[model samples]
Target chain A: MIRRLSQARERGIPEATVARLPLYLRALNGMAERGLATVSSEDLAVAAGVNSAKLRKDLSHLGSYGTRGVGYDVEYLIYQISRELGLTQDWAVAIVGVGNLGRALANYGGFVSRGFRVAALLDADPEVVGDHIAGLSVEHIDELEAVIRRRGVSIVVLATPAAAAQQVADRVIAAGVTSILNFAPVVLAVPEGVDIRKVDLSIELQILAFHEQRKTDRMTGGPAMAEEWPEAVDL
Target chain B: MIRRLSQARERGIPEATVARLPLYLRALNGMAERGLATVSSEDLAVAAGVNSAKLRKDLSHLGSYGTRGVGYDVEYLIYQISRELGLTQDWAVAIVGVGNLGRALANYGGFVSRGFRVAALLDADPEVVGDHIAGLSVEHIDELEAVIRRRGVSIVVLATPAAAAQQVADRVIAAGVTSILNFAPVVLAVPEGVDIRKVDLSIELQILAFHEQRKTDRMTGGPAMAEEWPEAVDL
Candidate 1:
């Protein structure tokens, strides 16, 4: 089933487009749950916080999933988006680093709702190894390889601390995982054909801070902000 | 200083591009720290994990800051990016929810490096108030209003659990914060002009899991895989 979907993806869809499909799926599901059977591009766009044109363009890439007169059939759209995102298949995920963030991710309600299952929970510390988290018992990090093979887990989520992320990533990759969702701050160097997506909280915060700072700066007319040339600075 | 940058942003720069200025600034600073005086678009793009063309386009939105032949002056580029990001003025930030993630952000080096100062930490827990964390004392949630006014805090970082997130966000908005970095899973409703950026670790992980599932399905051509879809739910 998964192979067939990959073949479908290979038939032409870009990965970037695939990533946004779930967001669309979530919005459509919400509309369905609200008892709305059909939605126009405008309605879905507002709910998803995206531009209607972009949404329409994105859906167009998925091949006329919506009607010309009607916007979209909520249930049918949900299934189509799910299929495009490759969410119509089961995926067993292994999570490393059962710390606060790790545990939070494991316990996150969104993960279970989107079609992914947490097959294994792992921690390096012996103290946390025997602990039960989100209905799954935390396993020792040493058992990662065996568990990955046993569960046939292909995707790994790294919620480890910055210092340990790379090491954990290395071990996970060595265990035969092909895709990684990194929550740690540092970058992970993956071999060709492997996919890595990073979610750095600090980085996101910094980006927001930058904009916030700019907004505040504009409100205050201070001369110290004289035009400066663009130059790289050492941290 | 911040005002000028904000005006510049309003003039024409895309909000998405504006958000990346701080990242470029940080990367430039890192390069400078290593004694680098100049960097090409390619070099900086690699450090930033962005394509050279996209990086160039983002910078171009801020005006032609980079020289065609010389690439970009390290120090000059850093200054320009920092100024554009409004990092020249220190931003007083209030961190709500003194949980593990909050503590981690409080201790994070990125914030300090980019002109964001942790002005106050607040929590609803009575026992946590007055406790020292990372050199700052955690204050009671009741004091949020007073602290925001006294310190002129303009940005709030919501690291609270989902249950308390909306309440915290409401209070923060009422206290006059115009920009928020929400780490909570829930959607925050803010008045017009208030910016809210969310970082959902679980959502990101689930997106990766979706792709991982596709990979596995593609690898194994089994008929039973079609039945795996209904079981592969994400929270």
Candidate 2:
């Protein structure tokens, strides 16, 4: 997915701008729900938690410049951003593991609100295979390829264990799914064209810890590195 | 979180390098588990799915330059990265919603493997409030501040509904929590010095949809934009 997002740079839109488009779309959707017809750049930026100047520059990439006085038409901008993000078309997604995270994702209200539909759920455990969840029966892992072919699932979400993640990913790619959203902790290696986006719960916590430590260091004098590295003062 | 990450620049490490530190640490840990004492930059880069030169530069920021012939000491590099990322100390994390997603987070093995501990599970629903999940009782939302103070929870994960996210965020901030990982679909507004990192499942799908749409458009001639914007030619 990193490679593909970088490829977005060649399409006249920067990768950073491609990421922010979803943020803009999400904000616009909220405004439309609130009966907002038009919004100024400053107002939209505030709602999106971004500065007004950066918001304007990002929108310019989509060729969307709001009227000076009227700002941007909320409905039109939603349509434009949605279209740009390919959310206007329905996408079939398959969940490849039926663990707790998979169950949460299957029932998550966010997916159906957009153009995504959880078409299938597969598991290796026979006890869970026939179980019902979120109005869909859990299919056996043996039927993964068949399910993808039958439902035309273009994307697969892997919520399997770290040990099972790579094997599941390989099978899905072989089944012709190009895009993957991985929740496992392992780093998956795929072919050149295949796109994989990993969501590691631990990594996010580590990042938060890094900043928290910095905040603590500021309150104290600095980090206590002398005990760990008594001989190294330069670092 | 954006502001805090950019602050890492003043500490001599780029925000990009700080982000990749976790990846390097994960790779090094795997090598240590396999009883490997040293690793070449090329080998570690392959495990982390990054280029060798980039990996070398990222480590250099930590004052860790691998020996020319012997390469990097696996256990020592792990300690350095862990110290740099503040993973050497434990962080008490309070999850503010007992939904399916929250339950998954509590049960996720990845958290305890690092420096994070799920100290509390909280929710507002009476039916779920007293239930035990992942061996911890789900406390009432009224106890949010008390739990934070009691458990020394410096990080809060908001898996609450979209409508309740902002209010919960306000309470956690008031409770002296500076770091937040929001899973709600809304964009939260936080005061300066508070760091927020959002993980939206739908946004990831939207990004994949954008790239998938581009692939489809390329297979065909071009995107069928004329029907949507007949008057606009330059876009």
Candidate 3:
């Protein structure tokens, strides 16, 4: 048995930093696309919607402080960040759940590129299971384990309904997939070693709503304290 | 002249904290659904997948120090968080780009509730323009300004392809949309005082790939350190 597993936590790059790496990578790539050979930290920060100081700090974690006066070479930085983010190699991804969101995810052109491939699509609905999407056959949910193993899938995308998300997650975990991208509008309980990242549309909306509400509050004086609370919320 | 703008920055709630607030709110709402009247910081932390100490710190930012030992009242905390998150009011959202992802977002079930309504859907394609999705008729993107004004669309979701994203972002920002949730795989440059949040599918996969590669490295005595590096990434 292994003594200690070297996971992301042990790697020393903060989780927040890991999340922002892709942002910087995207910004650098954009510069590269525009034929810019080098980017100042300030310029890249403006592109990434971050400040120059924070951008420098985040890049430092990648072990590349970049030459101070010369700025960062767009292509070299892309390679280093891609290496750190494990985007230099290819990954086969299996997206389970073929509902509208699932279909959308499967059909999304941006889903497959730069070292990520949609290996297979699985859904519980009989009608959807037989359909072809984004060049992959929609396999039945019954073949969940088979498809995962056969495709050598290390990551599973859970787009199942809320009621089915947990069960699907449980099955995928049992099949030895440790990484999951969940789009279901429910919280999934997974084992300790597994990692799950969730994408909920309404949740994002709620966040935007909060800020918009703040704007309305400022315009009309402090969230209209005089108005009665909605009945749906029992205050 | 207008007064102080109520940007999230001015409120002193760090962007990181603002993001986690939604996570906590989701967890709290799940607890309320299960009829939990009160929750200790530890339990809530477990439910939200963060450490209790960090959870306490995040909650403390909300000016809510849930009663020690006695725990936090679930309904009241829900209200506080909901109010702070602006879920207490409805936000009309317009989605531009009626591609597969856009269609899915339009039909997404979890989207309509929680004070967020899908006000309109627009697309640049003439073939896609006249289509109906999620009970809203898809409109032409040329009418983007008209739709934003007439429908009171406070937030715009950009599901357009990478090339079109920046241009569409410019148009929407000019149309008076202050908030944007971008799904395109490109970095968009927005004017000052505008807020943009991005949700990228492949980027998430790339992050997961990093962690998965770590697991492989641990099991295989370190990533076959002998492989030739990929070619020079041209700028």
Please identify model 1 stretches exceeding 4 Å from their true place: A1-11, A14-17, A63-71, A125-132, A135-137, A222-235, B1-45, B50-80, B97-114, B121-143, B160-171, B186-192, B222-235
Considering every candidate listed, which one attains the maximal DockQ? Answer: 3
| Ranking of models by DockQ | 3, 2, 1
DockQ of 2: 0.26
> Which digits, one per residue and each the tens of the lDDT, describe model 2 over residues A62-106?
774478778999988898788888887767788988998898888
Question: Fraction of the real A/B interface contacts present in each candidate?
Answer: 0.29, 0.38, 0.44
Error of 1 at B33 (Å): 5.5
lDDT of 1 at B35: 98
Cα lDDT tens digits for candidate 1, A177-219: 8789887766677787678987766566566666666565577
Better of 1 and 2 by lDDT: 2
Docking level for model 1: acceptable
Ranking by TM-score: 2, 3, 1
- In angstroms, the error of model 2 at B161 is 0.6
Error of 2 at A65 (Å): 5.1
Whole-model Cα lDDT of every candidate shown, in order: 0.73, 0.82, 0.79
Interface RMSD against the true structure, candidate 2? 11.1
Cα displacement (Å) at residue B217, model 1: 4.3
Candidate 1: lDDT of B20? 63
* Model 3 alpha-carbon drift over 4 Å, by segment: A1-11, A31-43, A53-57, A63-69, A221-235, B1-17, B36-42, B52-70, B221-235
